[model samples]
Target chain A: MIKNFIVLLFLFGLGMIFSALLLGYTPDSELNLTGRYYAEHTAQDLGAANIVTAIIVTYRGLDTLGEVTVLFLTAAIVGMLLSTGAGKGKSLQRKLSQSGELLTTGSHLLVPLILLLGAYVFINGHLTPGGGFQGGAIIASAILLILLTDPLYRFSHQLISIVESISGLIFLALGVLGIFFAGGFLDNRILPVGELGSLFSAGAIPIIYSLVGLKVGAEFSSMLVNFSETEDS
Target chain B: MVTIAMLTGFILILMGLYGALTNHNILRMIVSFSVANTGVNIVLVAVGYIHGRTAPILNEAVPAAEAAARIIDPVPQALVLTAIVIGLGITTLMLAYAYKLYEMKGSLDISKFSELKW
Candidate 1:
């Protein structure tokens, strides 16, 4: 107990030191507004009401593409690690029978709603706080729920891989198109800039977000399935 | 005030760090890491907070310049959203690995599992 207390104290001290050095420190000038300028100009240029959306889908879209690729690669790695041939030992099979009926039924009922919500979040990401990553995680959670409730419900690996690959290809193609037409990679002005705050506005952001949402959802669901199957094998 | 919130967030992070460092169980460590990550995200969002502000949007009621003037920083919110996604991905991966390790070793204890060591 004494040792634990000492360790806690030491950690507390370290945390305080770090927080003091980092958190409490303010910027050198309050008038410095690089992000503000970018926010204002990019909003008009990209026809997006949300500057962050403009940044994610237009300015730093290459980074977002890379992020989606990372998720895809992660899913693939997890899949490879967990996959085993058929006729594995029975010791790996999950005991789904032990779980309650209510849990299973509730998850079954909630899956569609969760999926809809995820799609909505991605679709309206340009106008809201949520985006592709958030939506994808929500969709992935639905798959996770199904996995927990019904262990025998196997994922169609071929379909998932195809979805992932197709979305990734489309995303890359869109980026290339932006370069060819808009004079830069992932530029949003390729499409006509409709009125601000309109659904048709924010050229390429909503579309990119949708693609990202699909890719992330499929990848994460594949990861979950892969992980669960490894245990079953 | 934002400062107080920041302080509280830091304290939570400290607690999470302690839990992660001292815990013997792999699940506990992962949960603690998540807690710490959440605390950091909270601090980031808090840093973007304005004393008196509204969401960043322009409409018939609110003019564009007025909206921009009163709006709280959207950059941090965007950043936090991305962080949350990445965090979810990493946490899921960790949980998956933990599950795999449990299957192979039949134990959740970290100290006993040392198959890959140089």
Candidate 2:
């Protein structure tokens, strides 16, 4: 009863905070200075049609780098936790029931298509609503499909680690290259802005996003692999 | 209106918090936290939505020169995207922790693990 009372009190405090914020906020009729600046200068500066991509990849590249690192750290920790003998491995001598042949065949057909779509999403991120993170998740889900249907399927841990490490290295190099070639780190001016709205435009932004996509995909795949390796999947 | 969305998100967050605080199952608590994180994402996105403008993209539809007049703010959307990915990572890590806890104790009850509690 005391715990419930305390919880209700905390919730009431939270509710008060929300009401205060709601009372204070006013919808701006015009873009504020930062928004206005990004809106006006993003296309001209980054040559990317998607302003969000331009902001995420160029204006705020360091933050994205940190976000990717957090993902890497999570995957690493999960890997460590699930490694042999790290967690209690009960010897359950039971085999998982086989998935239907039709389901397996359907997943086999759909996996490649999903992978292709994931590729398309990240590749076109500079021109559309999607980006590296969304694309990476889609790729991970495709791998998840295979894991669910094929009980005995095992992705090569070595291969996944290799993909992850190489992409991360490339991402770091791209940031370092920005320091030398561009105005500063991740300046997006390193390459010709090119014509706006073109697939090959946005200079290194698309490349960076693609690298991020690959790294994220690999990290998520590693996590899935870790989770599925348990005695009971 | 934006208020409606924000209100809904706030309610979801409160409900999630209540669920997390009251639930005895570790997995249920984790799920409640995820729900709260989702509420946060929704609030962040809704806070950035403008009345009638399009997304902050420049093209034939929204010209480069007049983008400020035609588009919603892109900063919040970018922040929310990053937040969502980080949330996913954290959720996965928490689940792994829960699984380890279960493996060690053969139980999923949060109340059962009182060794660290002073």
For model 1, the stretches where C-alpha displacement exceeds 4 angstroms are: A1-6, A18-32, A84-108, A231-233, B57-62, B114-118
lDDT of each: 0.76, 0.89
For candidate 2, lDDT tens digit of each residue in B1-118?
8898898889889989999999999999999999999999989988888899999877799989889999998989999999999999999999999999999999999889999999
Among all windows of 10 consecutive residues in model 1 chain B, the one with the lowest summed lDDT is B56-65
TM-scores for the candidates: 0.87, 0.96
True contacts kept of each: 0.27, 0.78
lDDT of 1 at B55: 61
- Say what the RMSD of model 1 is: 3.1
lDDT of 2 at A167: 88
Question: With candidate 2 superimposed using the best TM-score fit, by how many Å does residue A78's alpha carbon deviate from the native?
Answer: 0.8
Error of 1 at B21 (Å): 0.9
